[model samples]
Target: MILLAAHGSPDRRAQALARGLRKGLERVLGVEVLLGFIEHQSPTLLESTLELGRRGGGVVRKRLL
Candidate 1:
């Protein structure tokens, strides 16, 4: 599983771009990709972390942007 963590921006375009980039990465990597925002967005890092733990009860490798 891959978590695509981004800093939330007030500009919606930037957030949309992040989503699109995350989707592209998923397609290219062919892996589970989860998106989370550092702030100003839903499903923050802590939420994502808990969800990931529930899905897989072990270590989760993370990549941040």
Candidate 2:
């Protein structure tokens, strides 16, 4: 599983970008990918990571900026 964390935005355009990235990662990794937020959005890093861990033990990578 891969966890992508970013500074979320209230702007629709920014959110769409984030969602696009998440989808791209999912396709590239061929595994479950989680989208998380550092601020605006919900399901933060901690929560996403925990959920990923609970699902199964696997690689957890984060792309944060």
Candidate 3:
């Protein structure tokens, strides 16, 4: 499981862009991509990490860009 940690914004466009990027990454990487925000958004990084654990995903690898 890949946990994508992003610096979130209140702007809707930022949210849309994050989702779109996650989708594109999933397509290109052929892996499950989970989106999480560091701040100013829903599904915070910690929340996403916990959710990932619930999903039975192991050895989370995080990358921020």
* Candidate 3 lDDT trough over 10 residues, lowest sum: 56-65
lDDT of each: 0.75, 0.77, 0.82
Residue-by-residue lDDT tens digits, candidate 3, 1-56: 68788888888987888889889988998988888888888799899989888998
Error of 1 at 5 (Å): 0.9
Which runs in model 2 stand beyond 4 Å of their true positions?
none
Q: What does the lDDT come to for candidate 1?
A: 0.75
TM-score for all predictions?
0.81, 0.78, 0.80
Name the top lDDT candidate: 3
lDDT of 1 by residue, 1-65 (tens): 77777777878887887789779987998887777788888678778877877788433444443
- For residue 1, model 2's alpha carbon misses the true position, in angstroms, by 1.0
For each candidate, C-alpha RMSD in Å? 2.3, 1.7, 2.0
Clashing pairs in 1: none
Clashes of each: 0, 0, 0
Give Cα distance to truth, residue 31, candidate 1, Å: 0.6
**Number of backbone clashes in candidate 3:** 0
